[model samples]
Target: MVPNVVQKGEVIAIDGEWWNSDPIKVEAEAKLSGGAPNVSDAFTINGQPGGSYNCSKSGTTNFSVEQGKNYLLRIVNAAVNNHLFFKVASHNLTVVAVDASYTKPYTTDILVLSSGQTADVLLTANQAEAKYYMTASVYTTQGFYDKTNTTAILNYVGSNSSATPIGLNIPEFNDTATLVKPCEAWLRRSIQWTYGHSSSLLLQHIRCLYHRLSFTSPVEFNYTGDVPNTLWAPICGTKVKVIEYNATVQVVFQGTNIFQSDNHPMHIHGYDFYIVGEGFGNYNESDHNPFNLVYPPLRNTVGVPVNGWVAIRFKADSPEFSCSIQKFYKFVKFDDVATTLDVSKGVLAERVPVGRDIGG
Candidate 1:
């Protein structure tokens, strides 16, 4: 843990959302819409749909806070298929960690969490003695989506019980500018990885895996721009790139317009990597020159920006686990196998051992 970097957690709160939907119906809808699942019937907090949702006011998730104390909220984006913008009315959040990895404290008015990502933020109870709304609203960059915002209650001790809670103003559903703040500011340390951009059918990918074959089709045009119908098809296959143990590697995840340009929450299963650099448009090799190697945000999952790219790096040292990277984007049915690190290998006579993992 970073010494003295984390704030005091006088109170702890678990923030997450639950979806009210039928599993069988949701699956059928995805198949019918080419993997697009039906919008969540309700966005809930701690299983309560909050005051704004139907007659759930009495059941809204509430946390009592004392004046001058701090509450550490462990926020998780448990939504099935949406990136969410989280914030509290009249409160600034100091982000201390993400995905269980400590990061330099960065304060902001709002936080954008892609599905499957987690954040630890400290919220100080310094506002007037009243109730306020803690909210999560959908954040996207392309196509139609559910624009609903869910809320919970942040009640100050001794506040009027019947007083109306101040509401929060979330960014617009397609607010890409607001989403860039956290992605650019998250910091820690490490080297890099670039993930290829494409979508493919799970059946075709599995077929490649079964035959021990690799298929990686690259889009040479403007990835973030208007993509033709010819480039919209899935690049089906299991593409693997092996990395040696203890090697500093860079993997860049490039966002494409094949189907739509949207934020993808890319996650590495067995490693915490440093997000050294990220930007919009196609990635240039020169982008590596400005990487924040000294204080890059170390995380297990990072949101590859809409129509942009993100570079992550880690040393292949985990000698027992084969890491796999998965993109937590809505409607994606298969994990892209872009980079596989071979770390299970033991040290040879003169060569050091290597780690194994895949990035897509």
Candidate 2:
């Protein structure tokens, strides 16, 4: 486990063992210089520095955190597939917000985090004596991966003399915390019934609104002709023409036969977005869609249906537009091997502004 001192805009490194087994390397790199690092590679703790692992690759290092008395823990599942449960031992972690919006703070022993979902917590480690473990492990809500990874350890001040604290036992996924589903209304109501109150009024409100909305007919189109035609033109236009910093951007991710999953956890960098709405087969135009007009979750990542489409709306508002938003754009272009093969056609080109923001 990795122990971190709460500070605003401070980057923290996480690496440890999972399920009492071998150690797995967990590293997060900052997206915007001093912010929390995005996970790039997954490595075995016992393997050599540049060895192979699942979810994350290699060369991914240093997750960042802000330096302040109270801050948010922006957790993202870099793993292509896997849900996680994050918890800190011997402390009542108060979740202040989620997906970058302020919410009523509620104390909890553990927080359930899904792939591509970010949770912000207000943690104060004021204990004078005693060591606590802050853990992020795989949840068995769906299927099983090889083993859960040890994300970090939170050591109380004065627990150890040295700057690096000793590791703690990796918690088992079989624990009750891992099995519970906090998203279900019944389960949440049960918690409120037992605790006699609710901590997340925002979540409660969102859940009510989400269920109340009636889904319209799914939008459909010919995948082979329409998608390639639509995507290729924009991609070509965006690649060659200089894009203004203030341009409004919309990215629609439509899953194909190659990627046959029902849903994909789509993540964005630099800015949070309104989900708008999503459907099973295709997006609809006509029925009463509440999410179309109402405010959805403001998040950095969202899940796109496997055979359907998920539309995301966001403004290009980052100072260093190139650094903050380039990664996501790069991933989309290189998603298929055929696109990478036509370099001579200038399908993939690099553009650099000479005197741009050097910090990015």
Candidate 3:
């Protein structure tokens, strides 16, 4: 039985898995940087570097959930890097909200979220078992950055239980469209809002915030295995996306890959916007126009396709600060500035970075 809460229940997931079994077991690289042996040059969870090099240094945790109780897990990917897959063993997570937007109740064994996305899941401990394992692992569409499988114990009070953690089907580290892409297409916006469909009249007044905050993947270091090259750095800037208050805004993210081709999970700070359009190759003017303004799935964070692009739309009606974070596979990460920037009272925007161009 799903609870009734308008604009309060949506679901999103995260995956950025890596762990150092041995802190000093860095692999010698063909590239000039981060080669030989260095634990500091690795992917991380929370903030600590992770590696498959050391098994004794794992960061598994323990937690308890009372039986017959309904717990809402507000999961957030505040990490500046990597998308992650999360789930509780033997429990069907009922997703209720995503990025502060309410969504229809949907159950699944595993949930995938990119960096900066949030999912509010209702955990109902209805099973007879008294213990389970909650897991969060790396989700890679391009290549593996880390394979850290962070686990936590879910123990129920006042009952019998096993010492071993229960098993779950958290999607494989590399299953993108196989396990992830369908989930991305499955999310639909709530029906409680006014005008469930977008009208062309409303579409004509679209305030397109079209600008390419472009970054390219390098081609110098190509380490192909399960692990991606831990050498080449993807460069980006601290961009402030300024928009209007109480007005509809749409933004497109175009991705480029030269060295290593990968996908990016773009997250927002304040509100869940409609994921109107997305595809491969560059986002064109004629082809990508006239978006699916008719009740597209709304999410705070969306995936900019691997070596492609994604377009999203939302209204800057909420009076608060928000952020748009861009977490590329091994390179770029953006700040959580806000969902919409209110530059009213004749104030337009923060000083434009010199040599920067505003296309919209």
Candidate 4:
């Protein structure tokens, strides 16, 4: 949960407990403070320091809140395999931002958060209560692993007391049984264009060969099919090859029974995009047509509809470092059999044409 403070350097303590289990670990670090030391290295539960709890863990950490101002509370779900929804038990927390984007401030009783997702909240402590609880619980979304409620008590000194702050009751959430069906369908469609059966593979190989030839010779070519043309236009003609970043991206997600399912949260590194549109049951234009094509929420990641297609667009731009195009190149095979190209001609040509040129 986010906290509202007066200024920098105000000491604040956070405390909480995991419901029905061993206390969950709590670790808070200052992101701005070089290396951002783990300010909250300790753990606690239900006002008690340590005890034998079956399914939850508790902890507390102290930090200096700035004076006369607004600050961002960046929370990460380091929990191994649980989806958590967070809220301030007695306060109206304004979600001004999400995953680092400045969204319209929306007040809610609880914030539904997923594993590996981060949320920042804005809280104003204009009272003299001195202490209140920030609550986090598991969402019932599709494929959710852990099921427990956790609470973090935030204490503010010299603050007025209020019987109830604002939003307290945590709403019910279902991630798996409600959100996975659409996401799965979208994922299936996305991979088909890139890594489908025979025809798709042949097309990909042809495109890769074309790119390699363009790099060595002063030529340009374009080929299109299930693969979108706009996505490959820029690299249609290029020479110099550079390698930089490489990562293994995998999505091994599950759903409930697979029919009437829930959407899955899909994320990609390096860029953000809009959902644009989605559809279910084979993406038929006539059958499934309702979609917001105008102005959807621009997000780094999105939840694809159950049993449908999720389309996203991202600019292939990376200023920090170039990503290796080799992964795509490696997947291209000439046919059912793999053939090796003889590079002796090119290598010998490079050696003979440095300072002088031979002409008839």
Which candidate, 3 or 4, has the higher TM-score? 3
Off by over 4 Å in 2: 1-83, 89-119, 124-133, 139-145, 151-259, 267-271, 278-282, 286-288, 292-295, 305-309, 316-360
lDDT of 3 by residue, 292-350 (tens): 66557678677655535567777666544444333333221121112223423235544
Arranged by lDDT with the best first, the candidates are 1, 3, 2, 4
Better of 1 and 2 by lDDT: 1
Candidate lDDT scores, in order, read 0.68, 0.38, 0.51, 0.36
Better of 1 and 2 by TM-score: 1
Q: Looking at candidate 2, what is the lDDT of residue 231?
A: 28
Best by lDDT: 1
- Scored against the true structure, residue 329 in model 4 reaches a CA lDDT of 11
Worst 10 residues of 1 by lDDT: 201-210
Model 3 clash tally, residue pairs: 41
Lowest-lDDT window of 10 residues in candidate 4? 198-207
lDDT of 2 at 71: 44
| TM-score for each model | 0.82, 0.41, 0.59, 0.45
For 1-360, candidate 2 gives per-residue lDDT tens digits of 123544444222222222223212221122224432233333222221211233333332322222224444555444334445566555556655565565445566666554545666566554444444455665442222445354344544445533433333444654433333332211232112111110100000011121122222123444312243342322221211222344444444544332112234455444676655543343333312333534344556554433444455565444332322221211222321111000112133453432223231
Q: Between the candidate structures 1 and 4, which one is better when assessed by lDDT?
A: 1
lDDT of 4 at 26: 19
Positional deviation of residue 257's Cα in model 2 after best superposition, in angstroms? 6.5
Tens digits of lDDT, candidate 1, 1-360: 334443445444344445467766776677666756767666767777788766787888898988877778888877776788888999998888888888888889998877777888888888999999998888876567765667888999999999999987779888877887666555322213334443221111111111232334354676766668886676555544445566665667777766656677776666888788877666777767767867788888777777677777777677655566665555435433334444535542322222233223
